[model samples]
Target: MIPAHEKSETHSKIDPDLNSKGVDEEGETTDHNLTYYQQMQEASLEQLAEHRALLQIFNLHQAGRIEEKWKENESLVVWLGMQIAILKRDFTEYSNCPAHEYNGENRETDEFDEEKELNELHKKVLELTKLRLLELGMFDDFPSKFELVETSRPSKNTINKRFNKLLRKIPSELFPSIRELKFKNYIQSILDGIKKITIGHKIYYNQVTADLEEKGKLKFDYLFQTIEFLLRDHFISENDLKTLFQEDHILRIFSIYFFHSSQQGFSSMVKQLTPSFITDQCFWKFGFSFSQVLDEKDKVRMNFELLIAHLFFNGNRLRGFQEWDSFEKSFGRKKYLDHLKNPDRLKLSTSLQVEGKEEVPPLSLIGTDQEFSGDVNNLVKLFLATLNGPKKTRALSGLVCELLDFINSNISPGILDRSFKKLGSSKNLRLQFDLILIPTRINYSMAVAMEFHDIAERNGLSLAPKVMESIFISYQDRVISLNKELIKVYSQFKNRYGSLSSWLKQNPEYSKINEKSLNQWLKAMSIIIEECATEAKELDRRIQAAHGTAH
Candidate 1:
């Protein structure tokens, strides 16, 4: 800690500088105080010899001279004396005393002629101090080294054991077939996502984060599909792929996959790959020479079409909505259109409707598997509207109309209101059911929309009711199972009470209690539970009838 006197002196120094600059002593005018704080910090750090020693040690270690200086002596006796002299001189110079003082005797002049003597003394002291500083090596140009303990490197066996431990954390299931087939070569390539290179068949992952790869296997399913697409497009050949796998040259494959993944369109892949190999050269059998680069618009259409095809027909995973079993059901039922109320909608004669003859198909099957036999002009108009229109309801209405046409169902506002009433008229239950209805409605809506487009007669002969039953089983089963559990718990509570009325009568001492309201609520819940059980049983019956399965 600095002394109070020294702090006063520091304040006085700051006042002079502030007064000279016409700034306030409080420093309110300045927006930044960082400079003042930084100077104080620097001074504090400099005054501490230990801090300087630590800095010097760090420098020496970085320069690879730590081992050489690890045994050097660091005695500070000589430095201590020099520091004391410097402090004494500074204190004397700054003291509030006259330069000269009369000796304790009668004299010719009141002031003694000791000014020159004091100057001579000061000069001699300064010279002596300089000599001492040099002798003590106080301002020597060389950096001081600190004595640090030497550490030994781990033995090869120890290193091997640690490396094996890290490798064991990764599961074998996540390993590629190439990794499984070629152990030695696979070890050289990047198994984990740690960014490093192999030099002369030695793996060198970043030592700073070597254990990062042990966290878990990252999902690269998207990258895998992209690889498959490239192979199909002949952008990469089968033989080359096999060679990469055999040699464990995964980096090359990664290079191409990431490049294509980040780019906009499939034509970009062709443009990018063309430069890597000759089109008309020896490896021309993959149809590289004659392939034309698609324009941006065409590429978008083709890729979008491919995306829809993969998602609906080829059973590809949808990005975020992969969790719901209903999503899987929707994808699986793409083959069974036996339930369509309007089967003629599947045989899209034209994309438009003739005024007197027929009504237009509600859902425009833009990326259907077969060529769109619809009117191209109307299709273009709808496409443009979908792309540029501000209202999503226009698109949504089309989907709803299509679904209604398929399910042979109609929505009446009265019916919906009545159905909601059955959930419960109480505010709390209404709110709960409202929340549950959001997801339920979404599931049902999506199921109808997807199942309507099942033009492929892939699944065997099944009736309309059976198709609806299949689409609804996952959702209904979940609701039934949940409600059944709730009923079981509530039944246990009722059994414990002997009856709700008995429990309510017993608790009448509580003034806030409304026994009548409680009885009504309990009775309503029992009815609700009974209805749920009945609905569940009906769903089970439908499921059984559809699949021809026993309970």
Candidate 2:
């Protein structure tokens, strides 16, 4: 244990990184003090999208990276030192020999082997460090030999100098008792510092963040659809698409599907497919082609509609409420409509902020997905206003990003409690359900709006009460099946956890690795989080299944 005088210094270093810009002197964590992963968890949805986009650029999701510049990094040097110390401690304890037992060498004897092991501990330390890092789902991404920088590699002397400098930064009041500091407590501080450095290393770029905020409004489902519309329009013919793309079919899926929403893979896939052929191409399709946008066929003067379409995902993601009416009537949803007054009073909105894209692909790619910055109050207000203004009650759900985010939150909550109950007490009851609840509600909301201009029949009209009940029955059955699968998952996770604990038992210092990294790796390997469709999607399946070919 450290003397009372040194306790403060030890606590100060062990608890917080004094040099880290965002932390307060008192070691209180601030927003700036958070690790990158923690910041990601708390970031706004728009911010999250940009961050994920940046990750795609860096290929960070594959594994963590280490840069050449980190060789001289104080935190990394200290971590290497700390790791070497740990190796020595474990080796000494397990060797069952005193430090004095080193009479230099015999070739084959166990005593000789012990001496050799002690001599080789440094190499073992590096191997142990890499193994530990790999277990945390990371690998060294340091530059190859030809890319080496001129800086000297970290050595014991450098580590000592850096560590001493760190020690000197402690308040003078705590300096007197430095000799009393405990080894374990000191190493723990190094661990904290190292973990923070790694977390920062995995994700750090000020400019990308700035770019995300600046261009966020342009990156939405409309972007993917816009890309698709253009992609389909790009090729000379179907044969052209097939010849250029290995997975050409992935592009034909006009909605958010596969990696279409992830700018990571999507950008890389289309990086070569630039549209230099026509700034006027929007005139060819969707009324925004370059030809249509030009003031005259040959003149370069731009049209407002062309610019608006370019900036906002081709003008369909957001539109006026009145347009919904015109679209339904002129574009043919006349059969489902009733007359309503002041349809033009409000503008419709959806397609979350270009920045606000969710990581999970929406089940349906449409304008109805919620806006990132919207509130429940606004959605509720819209619901109330429609009751009075539009007696016909069509073209609603426009202003609010309705149902996509939170329909499940209050939508007939607890109505399913009795339905969710199993009939038999037996755990093995097999159940089958057609559609999850959220998707069905999303479908219902879209049906009311008729954004796609389909008549009530094929749209979502078939999802009346009885049909909804059938879908619910399918969902309940799926829930039971999911529970059974979860039980098996639990058993597998238990075994994995036991194996991890047993491995760590062989080296107690492994406990000091970052808890977040451990948990992330554990959860990823175990698949603890469930994956299912968004509300828009489940509704479609439910609808299609219900009306596959009625008599």
Candidate 3:
């Protein structure tokens, strides 16, 4: 006899017939498919959510607990795994099948990952078993004090493993070599490749190398100039450059190189760049990605600060060398003339004004397709998307610095004082503007749950629990997709920016604010991260209850 869990009706609910429509031969059955579709969609979403929750519980369970459960499900689990393997085999070949030419019996199966479906089914089975156990009050059987004492006792191997785990959890900044293994490998390969190029072009390589290597030390200017010449001359292909320097690894490498080769401080190193280099219009010479060079230190706060200083004050967009290949190739094109014009009010004042120094040359804006504007609102969008993809917090942070730079450069002290008085309430500040205008779903959901619901209710608009659940779950997925690096960076930004703004307000001087702002931002970012994390926990509970998964 089939188990109640494996009933035909259960299977029908799990697998909707895609070809079915609202109409049926019998008038009474006309809405059957429609009802089925709605119910199936709802069940599908609940099951999907339960899959995630079960995965989390599995991850968090102790090894002993996992082993115990595995024993309970061993044979059925193995059979399910084999079935999944067969489904995967069929699915993989379905893509290449010639049967796709017809919609008849030879038609290819609809696109899907068979393994994924089977895994979901497996998880559902386990969830049902878990529910049954819960119903039986199995958890109410508490262990004796003696048993607890014995189970809690740690062995020598267990203690060592725990210590190692703690060490592994330590932030990567303290162990760069361990954390940046991929980066280190790539850098070494590039250096080796460059060193080998000297074999064929011995004279040219020696000349450049000798010029750059002054008294057993590599000069930064010489290094920059040589790299620029090599790139401009088509000595290095765009693909090779991208492979070597993509994702701002160049910034980290430069940081390491600077520590080794230069006695000058980070600020001094930046001071060497020309005024035009920092402005938005221009990309760098040979391309260097300086987005998150200091990401490991001070929890990305310092990275943001350095990026801002480098771009606005020291004058390096640090966009990376790949961009230079395109810009250099299109050098003479009368394109992007709009941006080539004097930057909008958004551009930070050049170091010429900051240092009270003479103009080095005519600051020719780099011609580009993208226009640079002073609008922090649009910039905040890029900042949020950066959480999901390639552009790091550096872009947002640099823009923040630019906004700060402009405010300090343009706004008077008395006006700034007035702005500070209205600071917490006013959304004019760039950071606050970002918090208000970023348009994140979670931010909106939080507002609705806390305040908007009441306003909506008064206006005769009501929010359904399902709508709120959807929003929170969507946000949870986004947070999960951020992986680790971005989560830390974003948390840091939300935390640090508040204090950074406050400190900047009190001090009101860019020169005085300096890197000391790093710690203040770090502390603030940590607090924000903790608060948001707590909120996420609460949201998870609500989501579970909505899905009928709460204990």
Candidate 4:
């Protein structure tokens, strides 16, 4: 009887057909094939019922719910073993069939060494059952049916024994080696027959060896086949191959292979290969290359491509390498030209004049793509211009450094400051300082102050009465103006003093003004500023005292 599962599988594969009998002239009554069909139907139903019962028993055993008495049920074991053998046979038959064409007939028949075939099939079933039992941790009890098969057909056992001996002789690992040797010989035979496959065309074999050596041994044939498939599929072009090989660097080759393989699999090869790699030195080279390339469109394309490549590779636009690459690719060459063509790009002005130094006005800043031709003359003109401008209008020490950076120069802060100071007076420049210039100048001032403080402290001059007084006063004034609470606190102090000048006589606790207490002072002063009145006058007094000036 057909099992329920097998019946379902068969039903899914078959379609019902209509059967007809002789019809009367009026088409009202006719003899039908109902009796024959009913018999077939009854047989099918009985088969299905038997199959269902077998399935129930199999499921019970599978789920470990079968009773101990039923564990050794020979009938159930035999049925299951037969089902497994049939499944394997059917699977092999279907696998071997040509998918594009079919002939209507069972491929296997009983006449062809049926016992040997059945024995072999039974062995496969036993192997699978053993594997299952192993997985279930029930390896001790192999079914007796497997052992009884040989005795049941003693003559057949001799052939089965020989086959089993041959199977035992074959090592699983050697199968692949044999397959490879056969494939190689087949290809060699083809070449020998064709007489066209020369050693020169065997470049791929060498490449495969080298790749294996470098990347660790892998399936060369598989990789080669994949590359061939990629080429055939138009996922990668000849240009890409040429470019990747032309580089010849091992790392670059590795990168290209990785990129190409991944992209081929996903069709993103073009995106992967479009970008050029970047490094610190690459920026300078790229800049130089951009300058060498004359056409604007070519320059833009090259620069933009480099920029995009840098961005893609680094995964950031503002990183150190990325920014450098972008800047050099974008404006390095163009700026060089502007330095030559436009005087404004190099302009400078200062108010203070020194002996033998000519006064100059500030040069106009050049825009991104403007042309300039003055070159050295523009630089000289800018220096002179910056010297002649108001002291505040002169470039700050940091600005000078940045300008040097733009020109790829290396002028020290002291030299730059001295150069500017020689040309312009500090007071005149101070009046012209804008917020843009203020931060730069303030930073420079703070830097200079820190340097001076460091040098003085190192030499024991920082603690001098005058220096200490000046620093204290300056810090106090800053604390008051910078923080409203400090101003308010100073106001309260002034109210207690009954006059601003009297409050100035009170010395601040300088020992408490160390770095550790600076933040505390700031907080305390914030409260004072917020709560105090007449704060500005008190602040002025403190500044005068600190500066060694009397109000």
Candidate 5:
């Protein structure tokens, strides 16, 4: 019998038969196939997310950018150990496959030496994700079967005191080396091979919005120039950017976009361009043998696909390399984009007069076939998807930086522009967005539970279990309402773009859009990280404090 915990992943057009059965491990038949689709999608998402994280580590190593100090990081060592003893103790009987197969014996390297290298790989991926996906292994949710869990969790104190299992990292050999990997060609085929997509299924195009030779020119230039422009003056120095982002890191990010676009003459040739783990996972289909799982007529499905595409693919959209990528790559829930700006109206208004240029070189606005605004809203969506995905929060944090770049990038000196910002938010981000936004039921949920936990810890008061449960229900409602409010606000803001005429585009909505927008964005972020969902009110100011972040 497949154990209840056995992971299954499925991503495809919904079987036209809702009459299809959804079966559980106990051989019980209950709901429709969508239930099973979600379950399998979620299981596959976990595999994809883990695969993506490991892939990024290899990418960092090849790029020679994994930090040297990661070699013996203790947190990493602890993170990469044997499987959780409790699971081995109890659930082993339920698992058909081991959480991981251990083969330390007869390997070329000593177990200690191999552990050390893997520790370093774990650390680098954590840092890499601190900028890109959900912080993995060392922080947030471990890719391991046991997640740290979502809201209303026991205080880190209570859980640590009870279950201090010394888990071992699985052998690295369980995974395929970059060369041995079989997913890339499949992804390219999705992009390069044009199936007979009808109107409702216009997710992929032959040129991929252009042609290969231009291989993501519009989005690439947009991200590069946007990063340079944002960091160029108000945020950091060119010298600092070089030090903060090495050539390999920057160039690879560029190539990620480059290969996915239609570069005029090189359209077909660009298919041969090396794909990154980011690209791979974003478009990853777990041997189901399909590039995309989309239905244009399904508005909800279209929304998921479009949002994923706009946020991760097309061009880096609002995402850019940041100063935080240099130091804040751990999986902590500290507000990642705090420096992007404080959302307090007065502070934001004062802070956002960041640009000094008057007639800057025309910004790259790639208006190919389809374009829409509200790039930043999708980071929140991406964040939501990561928890649900099997998507990682890694890109959520990094994309938060880019969202700031989108929000704070200039239309004219001293006035920030929202109307003109366009990276099209898809293609690679789209491909990955396409891949990642599977909206598998999130493995976890957070809210009032953590708040009560924090309240108990801060005040040193012990309440009865029933009392906490009652309070938990009450606070959860408010948190849910606040989430609705945020969605409503986003709807209003998005509609503003409908009438965003040439003048609105030229003048920009610095006052209209900046303060409330950042405030809502930051507040929502405060709520839904892997660690816990925060109470949204006043959270814009206390993003880090609420998360109990040490650094």
Candidate 6:
């Protein structure tokens, strides 16, 4: 048996041609024969046509129409020039054809071949005309239409032969200057103007922006005219056109134009040219241009506000709305009531601690005192600044937590309860909070606990008694010591009374209190109050906790 590599080589060397006839298996000989046959056929046809035309030219020379020969020759030259121009135009159009063809195949055939052949014939006619003109000594003097033709004209074929020869030596003068002049005067001139206008517009916008910024006041008329010119003449789309008007310094130019145009009853034109919706679309769709108008900071804020508003407006239609409801439901009714009652829990403090500035006053004082309102506004601004301008999840969550805390601390329980019911009816605040918070599973527990505390504290109540009872029952192991002490106290207090049942009948509020229930309620209240402390205490604890070592 052969080795594997040697066997593969042996198979590879076994040529198919070895089993075939004398023909090379590569097919080179057949391909060469086919190509040679085609070339020979083309050459034969060209030779035949040349010979026939020569004989015809000889015959035409025997006839007499010599005087009209020059006109014929000139006509042939004109026809050839026209054909060339048409070919050039067709070539250009084909070259720039759009990418609509499947698989990138060429679709057009050489349908202009007949016209090209006629062009060749005309070239020959021109050569005959030119030589005849030279022989008549009219080449030196400007030949009139009649002088170039022979009185005894050659046969048509002879004339055709002479024209073909003339075409081979097509002189710059053989082609009439008028045709060239017309092309340069008409087509070229228009193309040049288009090029100039494009170049000019680019330069003009750059210079105009620079000049306007330098002058500090842009001329409204010039700006408007420039914009219109760009749109109409340059094929500039609405987006690019708007960009020219977007530069802060340049756009100011339009402010005056806008006002003047509106005053002159050109409001419709202005609307058509620069609609607000279009402007907003341009800003949003093309962020760079939008940034140019509002600056990056304001643009971000604007977008964030718009996003929030859009989400709020479409909350019911959003899939996430159900999840938002689920989150609110998780916090329970009592928690939401607490949020409404306590404004302290809801009012987020500014993360920026401005030194030497008095603490922000109460909202009630905002209406009564101008300075107080100003301070509050400033504080609100500062808090808003802490929102990280826009679309900042961390900042938003912090703000939501602060607001809930503020409401929990400040708002009355009755008002908070009403607000909770309203929240349930409207459900808009849930959406608003969700837009800002973007709840995560990791932060879910914290958010729920914070909300629960804020709502309960604001409502001037504890967590639902049943909830406390449930927690105590579920986590009895964790609270067993506290429960035992509470049981001892309850037993002693009950012994001082008739019995556990009698004590409960005496005071319904405490009647059902077990050792575990008492402990859990106290623990739940402590958790709620601890989480609802003032900013100062919260900050201090956070700082110490950060430094504190775990035992």
Tens digits of per-residue lDDT for model 5, 319-420:
343322322232221221222222343243344333543213223322200122333334334432432221233435333433323333321121112322
lDDT of each: 0.28, 0.27, 0.30, 0.29, 0.28, 0.31
Residue 282's lDDT within candidate 4 is: 15
Residue by residue across 327-401, what tens digits does model 2's lDDT show?
322321111111111112111212321333322323331222232112223333333343234433312322112
Q: Each model's TM-score? A: 0.14, 0.15, 0.18, 0.15, 0.20, 0.16
Task: Select the stronger candidate by lDDT from 1 and 2.
Answer: 1
lDDT of 4 by residue, 1-551 (tens): 22212222222111122122211111211122233333334444432333333223244554353234233332233233333333444434423333211134342332133323333433333333322222222223322221112233223233334323433333334224324434234223322321211111111112211121211111111222223222222223333333332221322322223322222111222232222212111111111111221232223233333332222332222244332334334433344432333333333312223344322212322221123222222332333343334343232222322332223221111223223344465322321212122233223222332333333334322122342345434434544443443333345444443433332334121011234445565454344334333434454455555456322
Q: Give the residue spans of candidate 2 off by over 4 A.
A: 1-72, 96-115, 121-551
Residue-level lDDT tens digits of model 3 in 268-292: 3232321111212111110222211
Name the regions of candidate 6 deviating beyond 4 angstroms: 1-287, 318-551
lDDT per residue as tens, model 1, 64-141: 342222212112222223233333434343232332212433432422333233333334333323222222232222
Superposed on all Cα atoms, the candidates' RMSDs to the truth, in angstroms, are 36.8, 31.9, 24.4, 34.1, 23.0, 34.0
What is residue 526's positional error in candidate 3, in angstroms? 48
CA shift of 386, model 6, Å: 24
Q: lDDT, candidate 6, residue 387?
A: 35
Q: What local lDDT score does residue 228 receive in model 1, on the 0 to 100 scale?
A: 31
Give the least accurate 10-residue stretch of model 5, judged by summed lDDT.
2-11
